[model samples]
Structure formats: structure tokens, C-alpha cells
Target: MDAFFASVEQLDHPEYRGKPLAVGGNRERGVVAAASYEARKFGVRSAMPSRLAAQKCPNLIFVPPRFDRYKEISRVIRKIFLEFTDLVEPLSLDEAFLDVTNNHFAFPYATQIAKAIRHRIFLETGLTASAGISYNKFLAKVASDLNKPNGQAVIPPEKAEAFLEKLPIEKFFGIGKVTAEKMKALGIHCGRDLKAYSLVFLTRRFGKSGRHYYDIVRGIHESEVKPDRIRKSLGVENTFEKDLLTSSSVAETLTNKILPEFFRRLQQSQTAGRTLTLKIKYNDFTVHTRSRTFPEAIPPGSMEALALELIRQEELSGPVRLLGISLSNLIRPDDPGRQLRFSY
Candidate 1:
């Protein structure tokens, strides 16, 4: 999908087609969920403050998000993907990773499959899409974005390295603003620059993601697109629209805000963890995380303790826009004693 949420709005509203339009964030409290191409021309972008976007383009139209309709379109697009390969791993409601090593339609190539799918999407939903096909996830993700608005790009295995070489490090999916800035400061501005650093060096800087960066620069990624990527660590976090003046006030309110999520998930899993993690997504959306592992595993009943500990830690920091918690290093029910009342 390309410009998915906005495109869906355009498809359903004739007057919105080819007009500067956006979905989500029509209010002071909201952010841009998606921006149409016309909106993009005016410097409007996703995750930007909706108020600022309006200020940037006084004529920009902001439509309220319609998740139900988007979900319906997602289902329709998913069906199109399944026609070619059941090995489809949905990354979000609008995008997916498809393994077409052996496609059902027997399309001559992945480009053909991409074209057919795009065509079917237009025919069925009157919406445009773009696609990228490659031997692995990293290149494929890059390829998908190379062309836009019903376009397709394919990176053969032989050319993968060269293709990635010229790509900007910022365009690497996992590297957000903070990480990109860090890479730039280290004199890594693009794919070629990334490859200059040793794996040990990248790992030393990026922890677990360093290995991934090391392999992807040379187009040597083998990470599979798992259809069943479990909810390994369920958690919630927030990003505030404006800066907070105090930390303790936000800390006092965070549990009331975030603890419900844990309580809700505890209905489904054992909820044990060896670590209590804290993540803060600042006003600028630059995220920083802190974690403390415990000697005793976080019991399923420790949601309160976990929440309080996180709040205390956060109170000592400055204003925070987001708070997050996850029960890591979990042990399944069959191997452990029940410590809390749980549904599953």
C-alpha cells in the first residue's frame, strides 16, 4: 500500500481525489497518521503535529481516521497477496512481506506478481499501491519504496549489494531519527559508509541491531519473514504532543495511564519477566530506553510493583512523553507455578 490511510480516504470520497488530503490528527491532540502526495508537497508529513501541518498548508484537508474501513481494505489486499503465496507476513495493516519462492500463480517473476497485485487492488478498491521484490526482507523493503503510487522495483540477488550501497542510512527501516543521527555523527551517512564499520563496532554501538546492520549493508541478510511472529513481549508506550514542565507529575499519572494495558494482557499470558524496562519517547519523538533486570523474575502478579518502579525511575528523569513496560524472558505456564490470577 502507498499513502494507505489517505488513499483510502480518497477512494471513498470523490472530492478528495487529487486534492491535498490527510488522515488522522485533525485536532490539537492528534498527529498525522498519513499524508497524501499533495500534502507531502507542502512539507506535511506523517507523525507531524496536525496543528503544524495545517499551519504549513492552510488549505490542507484533514479527515478523521476510519480504522474499520482501513481494516476492510487491508483484508481485501491480503486476499490478493494470498492468491500468489500463502507465505505472507503482514507487518502492519497496510504492508506485508511475501515469500514468493514458489508462487501459486506461477508468475514469471516477482515483478509480474507485484504488477498483478497492484492492478487487482486498483480494480477492487480504486486505490494505488507500490511494491518491491528482492531475495530478502531488507532489500525488498527498500525496493518497495523506490517507486511510489502504483510502481514496482525489483532487486535481483546479484545487484542487491550495489543497490544498497547508494541508499541513505536514514532510509534503513529500523534506524529512527536518533539512531540515524548517531550513525551520521560516526561518519556513516549511507549504505556504503555503514559497511565500512566492523560488526563488532556496530554491535558495540547498537547492541542487538548491530549484527543486522552489519549483514544488511553487504546485502547478505537471511532473516525470515515469520508468519507467526508472536507477541513475544507485549507492552505500551506513549508520546506526548507537548513538553511537560515536571517529571513527578507525569510519573504519578503514568501508572493510571499504562497499567491497564498490562492488566488487560495478563488475561492472556503468564506475564512473567526477568527485566523491568522503561522507554521514553520524547516530545520530538526521539526515543530513549532504560532497563533494569531483577534477580527474581517479574512475577505475573508484579504489574503494580513493575509500574511503580518504572514510575519512580521516570520521576527522577525530566519531562517524559512516553512510558513503556514489557515482561521479558518469560517462562511458559507448563514450566512454572501460577503466581497470579490469570485467564489463560
Candidate 2:
């Protein structure tokens, strides 16, 4: 799916086509959920503050997100994926990993399978999707994004090492802003730079994830794509239009705004969990997360009290930019005492 949320908005509202448009955000504190290519040309992007997006593109049109419609279209796309292989691992509603090694049609090449799936998606949903076909998930995910909206890229096994060696550190999956900066400070700018470090040296510098970095840089990712992945946690979050100035305001938003939405989703999913986690992002973009796990499930009515307690436990660090609440260690009705999680 290309610019998924905004694309859906354009598809339903013909007037928005070819215009600078975005989904999510208001003129104030909200963030952009997705931006059209037209908006992207103006340097607008998802997770960007609405005020910043406006500054970047003065004529940017912000449409409220219609998640239900997007999910409906996503279902159509997933069905198309299943036609080729049952080993489809969805990263999000709009992106997935399909292990077409043993596809239903006995296709000899993954690129052929990718093209057929992309064609079917456009035929069925009237939307375009880009694909990356490779021998592993890391290369495949990176390749997919190389070509944007209605394009495909392939990286054969033989080309993986040379391709990775020249790739920038920031472009590698699983490396965040802080890690990228840390690598830069260490004079590591590309995969070749990263590969020069020993496993022991990287682990000492980057904690447990350093080993992951060491391997992925050398083209050593061996993770398999599994089908029917189970979700580990579910949550809702919001960025405030105005900085939350006090604990009372934060508590109010958590109970009045965030909790109701969270519980509604919980009820819809019919899932419960023993752990409740609260995430707070300061105005400076620094984040803090606190969690509480219980032997028994916390009742819905008690959630507000627990959430408030969690908020109070933290120092009123700075005016909060964003607040979120989630439930993890989930137990679904059909899977008792079973917990499954996804790692990206």
C-alpha cells in the first residue's frame, strides 16, 4: 500500500487526488499518521508534528484517519498474499513478509511471486504496493522500500554482501536515531564500518543488540518468516495539542481520553493481560516507560487508578509531549497460558 491512510482518503475522496494531503493531525499537537507523495515532496512525513508539517507544507490538507476503511483494504491485500503462500508475516496492516520458497503455484522465482501479488493487490483494491524480494527478511524489507509506490526491487543472495557494505547505517532495519548517532560518533558510517568491529567489541559497546548489529551487517540474519503471528500487546496513544503541564492533566487525559479508547479496543479484541505499561514521551523527545504486572488480571474499573499511580510514580520530568497505555503478556481466549510476540 502506498501512503496507505492518505491513499485511502484520496481513493474515497476524488478531489484529494494529486494534491498535498495528509491523514491524522490537526493544526495543533497531533502528529501526521501518513502523508501523500505530494506532501512528502514538501518534506512532510508521518509521526511529524502537525505544526511542523504545516510549516513544511503550508497547503497541506489534514484528514482525520479512517482506520476501519484502511483495515478493510488491508484484509483484501492479505487475502491476495495468501493466494501465493500461507507463510505471510505481516509487519503492519500495509506491509508484510511472504516466504514464497514453496508457493502454491510452484513459482520458480520469488520476484515472479512478488509481481503477481502486487498485480493482484492493485486489481482487487485499486491501490499500488511496492515489493522487495530477497533471500531473507532484512534484505527483503530494505529492498521493498528502495522503490516506492508501485515498484519492486530484488537483491539476490550473491549481491547481498556488496549491497550491505555500501548501505548507510541509518538505512539498516532495527537501528534507531540514538544508535545511528552512537555509531556515527564511533566513526562507523556504513555496513562496512560496522562489519569491521569484533562481536565482543560491539556487544560491549551496544549491549545485547550489538551482537544483532554485528551479524546483520555481515549479511548473517537467519530468522525465519512464520505465518499467523500473534500480537503481544495492544495500546492507544495521543500527542497533546498543548503540553500537559501537570500530573492532574496527564491523569485526566489518561482516564478520560486514552482509557475509554483503549478499553473499547480491548473489548473488541476479547483479550486480557496481566501487565499494564505506561509510556511517556517528554517534549524533548526523550521517552520513559513504566510497567506493572499482576498475578490476576486487573479489572477495567481499576485501570484508571493503576494508571494514575504509574504516572505519579514518575517525576513530573517535563511537560509531556505524548502519553500512551498498553497491556502486554496477553492471553487470548483461544490460547490459554500461551504468549506469542513479534520482533521486528
Candidate 3:
């Protein structure tokens, strides 16, 4: 999908179409969850601070997120994907990977399957989608971004090496901004530069991920398209308009705000966890985290107490700007040995 959340807003509200629009944020606080192409031209982008986004695009319009509506549309899109291929791996509400090697229509070309899927999505949802057709997930993911809005690109196997050699290191799928900077510092500015290093040298420099860097540059990614991807954790966080000045206020927010929302999501997902983590961001923008693991899933009644304990255990370095709680070491209902025991 193209600028998915913002695009959805444009589809439902004609007034927002073809304008600089953002979904989720305000002029005063919060973060931009998505930015329309119009806003992107003015340097507005998702995850940018709302204040900064406003400065970048004076005419940018901000709208609150409607996740339920997005999910509804996402389900419709997924249904279309399933009609073509059962081997579909969803990365998020707006993106997915479809292995069309043996599609329902038996299409000989993956490019044709991609075109058909995008067309079906636009027809059914009144939204535009882009696609990347390639022989592997890495190249496919990279190719997907080459085209914008309603376009598609393909990277055939024979051309993969030459194509990657010229591609910037920053353009690789798994390389983040921080990693790219680190690579650039070491004269690894492009895929060709990275390919010059030996496997042993890369592994030594990048630790376990060095091997990943080495393989991907050579167009070697063995990861399969997992149709059923298990979620590892569930969390919620809130950035405050004013910094929390005291431990008491932090504890109050945990008891009244954070834990309640976390529990609601956990119940909705019908999953439990044996580890509880506390994440804190200070006014200085530094982060700290603490976690406690139990022998069994933490009961609903014990959640508040455990959350409070986690907060009280640490002293505030300064005024706090954000607070979050998460549950990990998940126990889904279908997992083996799924007995719940009280160990706290």
C-alpha cells in the first residue's frame, strides 16, 4: 500500500486528498505515524516529531489514527492475496510477501502475479499499492521501494549482482541508519565495498550479523517466507506532554494508565507472558529498562503489583518523558506445555 495510513485517510475524506497530510500526531505533541507523498516532498516523514513535521510542511494536516479501519482494509487485502497464493507473509497491516511460485492461477511470471494483486487491492479498497518482484526476499524488498505510489519493479536473478554492487549500503533491507553510518566509517559505502571483505573478516567485525551482511551482498538470503510468524512481545508506551517529575507520579501513571492498556491488549490477544519489562525515557532523551522473569505467566491480578514494584525499584535520574511496559517470554494458548503456574 502507498503511504497506507495517510492514504486511507485520504480515501475516506476527500478533502484530504492530494494535500500534505499526516496521520497520527498534532502540532503540539506526539509523532507522525505516516505521511502522505505530498507531505514527504516537504521533508515530513513517519516517526518524525509532530512539531518538526509541522515545521517542515506548514500546510501539513494531522489526523488521529483509526487502527480498526486500517485493519478492516488490511483483512480485505489479505483475502485477495490468499485467493492467489496461500504462501503469504504479512510484515504489517500495509505490507506483505507473497510466494507466487505456484499460485492459484498458475501464473508463470511473478511479475504478473504482483500486478494482479495490486490491481485487485486497488479495485476492492479504492487505494493504490506497489509491488517488487524478484527471486529472493532481500532483492524483492529492496526493489519494492524503487517504485513509488502505484508502481512496480523487478530484479531478475541474472542482474542481481550488478544491481547490488552499485546500490548504496544504506539501501540494503536490514541495514539501519546506525549500521550504515558504522559501515561508512569503515569505507563500506556500497554493496561492492562490503563484498570485498571476507566472510571471516565480516563475522569478526560485525559479530553474528557480519555473516548476514556478507551473505546478503552476494544475493544469498536463505530465510523462507513464513506464513505464520509468531509475535514475540506486546507493549505500549506513552510520551507525555510534560515530564513526570517524581517517582510517585510515575507510579501513578503505571497503575492508572500503562498497566490497564497493556492488560487490555494482552487479554484481547489471549496470550500471557512470564517476563515483564519496564522502559523509561528521561527528559534528557536517555532510556533505561528493567525486567523480571517468573517461573510462570504473571496472573492478571498480580500485574499491577508487579508493575509498581518495577517502577519503585529504580530511582529517577531526572524528569521522565515516557514510560512503557511490555510482556515477553510469551505463552500462546497453542504452545506445548501451556500450563499456567503461579510463581510470584
Candidate 4:
């Protein structure tokens, strides 16, 4: 999907069409969850602060997120994908990777499968989609972004190496802003530059991920797309309009706002975990975390108690800006004694 959340909003609200629009933020506070192409022209982007977005595109319209509606549309899109191949690995509500090696339509070419899927999605959902067809996941993911809204790109195996060699290090998937900067500092500016380093050298420089960098530059990603990707953790976090100035205020916010939302998501996922983590972001944009793990899935009432305990243990370094609660070390359905027993 293209500008998924913002596109959906435009689909439902015709007045927003062709206008710079954003979803999930207000002019005064919050962050831009998605930005339409019109908004992007003015340097507006997803995850940008709403205030900065407004300053970038003064005419940008902000709309609250309707996740239920987005999910409904996502389900419809997934159904379309299943029509082509059962081997669909969803990255999020709006993006997925489909292994069409043996598709339901008996299509010999993955490109054909991509075109069919994109067409079906547009027909069923009235939205545009982009696709990247390639021999492997890494090249496919990178190819997917080469074209813009309603376009598709492909990188055959023969051309993968040359394409990767010229590609900027920053454009590679899994290389974030910080990692890209680190690579640049090491005189690694492109895939070709990265490929010049030995496996041992890369591993020494980048730790475990150095091997990944070495392999991907030479078009050597062998990881298969797993359709049933298990979620590792579930969390909820909130940024306050005003910084929380005291521990008492932080506790009050947790009691009244954060904890309820976290538990609601945990229940909705129908899963539990043994570890509870508390994440804090201070006004200076620095972050810290504390966690506790139990012998079994955390019991009812324990998450709240543990979260508060974690908060109390950490002396506030500065006025707090955000707080998050997460559960990890999940109790999977196949795990023995998976049933969660609640106790006060």
C-alpha cells in the first residue's frame, strides 16, 4: 500500500484528496504516523514531530488514526495475497513479502504474480500498491522502494551484484540512520565499499551483523520468508505534551494511562510473557530501560506491581518525556503449561 494510513483516510474522506495530509497527530503535539505523498514533497514524513511537520508543510491536515479501519483493509489485502500464495510474510499492516515460487495461479514469473496482486489490491481496496520482484529477499526489499506509488521494480539475479555495488549504504534494508553514519565514518559509503572488506574484518568491526553486511553486498541473503512470524514482544508507550516533572506524576500516569493500554493490547494478542520491561525517555531525548523476569508467565496484578517497582528503582535523571511497558519471553502456544494463571 502507498502511504497506507493517509491513503485510507483520503479514500474515506474525499475532501482530503490531493491535499497534504497526515494521520495520527495534532498540530500542537504527537508524531506523524503516516504522511501522504503531497505532505512528503514538503519534507514531511512518518515519525516526524507533528510541530515540525506543520512547520514543513503549513497546510498539512492532521487526522487521528483509525486503526480498526486500517486493520479491516489490511485483512482484505492479505486475503488478496493468499489468492496468489500462502507463503506471504507480512511486515506490517501495509507491507508484505510473497514467495510466489509455487503460486496458486501457476504463474511462472514472480513479476506477474506481483502485478496481479497489486491489481487485485487496487480493485478491492481502492488503493495503490508497489512491488519489488527479485530472486531473494534482500534485493526484493530494496527493489520494492525503487519505484514510487503504484509502481513495481525487479532485479534479476544476473544484475543484482552490479545494482548493489552502486547502491548507497544508507539505502540498504536493516541499515538504520545510526548504523549508516557509523559505516560512513569507517569510509564505507556504498555497497561496493562494504564489499571490499573481508568477512573476518567486517565481523570484527560490526560484530555479528558484519557477516550480514558482507553477505548481502554480494547478493547472498539465504533467509527464507516465514509466513508465521512469531511476535517477540508487545508494548505500548506514550509521549506527554508536557514533561513529567516528578516520580509521583510518572506513577500517576502509569496508573491512569499507560498500564491500562498495555494490558489491553496484551489481552488482545492472547499471549503472556515472563519478563516485564519499563522504558523511559527523558526530556533530553536520552532513554533507559529496566526489566524483571519471572519463573513463569507473569500473573495478573504483577505487571502493574513490577512496573511501578521498576519506576521506583530508577531515580529520575531528568524530566521524563515518554514511558513504555513491554512484555517479552513470551509463552508460546506450543510451550508446556502455556495457560496463564491469574492471581491477585
| TM-score of every model versus the real structure | 0.77, 0.91, 0.95, 0.96
Over 217-272, each residue of candidate 1 has an lDDT whose tens digit, in order, gives 89877878787655456676554555555665555556676667665765656456
TM-score result, candidate 3: 0.95
Runs of candidate 1 with Cα error greater than 4 angstroms are 27-29, 200-208, 235-344
Q: 2 or 3, which is superior by TM-score?
A: 3
Best model number under TM-score: 4
Kindly report which residue stretches of model 3 are placed more than 4 angstroms away from their true locations once superposed: 340-344
Q: What are the per-residue Cα lDDT tens digits for candidate 2 across 152-217?
A: 999888999999999999999999888999999999999999999999999999999988998888
| Stretches of candidate 4 exceeding 4 Å from the true structure | 341-344
Q: Considering summed lDDT, which 10 consecutive residues are worst modelled in model 1?
A: 335-344
* lDDT of prediction 3: 0.91
Residue pairs in steric clash, candidate 4? none
Q: For each of the candidates, give the backbone clash count.
A: 0, 0, 0, 0
lDDT of 3 at 167: 96
Clashing pairs in 3: none
lDDT of 4 by residue, 213-316 (tens): 99999999998989999989989998888889999999999989998888787777778898999999997778999999988888757678888999999689
lDDT per residue for candidate 3 within 1-344, as digits (tens), equals 99999999999999999999999778987789999999999999898989999998999999999999999999999999999999999999999988889899989999888899999999999999999988889999999999987999999989999999999999999999999999999999999999999999989988999999999998988888889988899999988878899999999998889888887887788778989999999977789998999988888778788888988897889999889999999887887887643432
Ranking by TM-score: 4, 3, 2, 1
Residue 147's C-alpha lDDT in candidate 1?
Answer: 86
lDDT of 4 at 9: 97
lDDT of each: 0.79, 0.89, 0.91, 0.91
Better of 1 and 3 by lDDT: 3
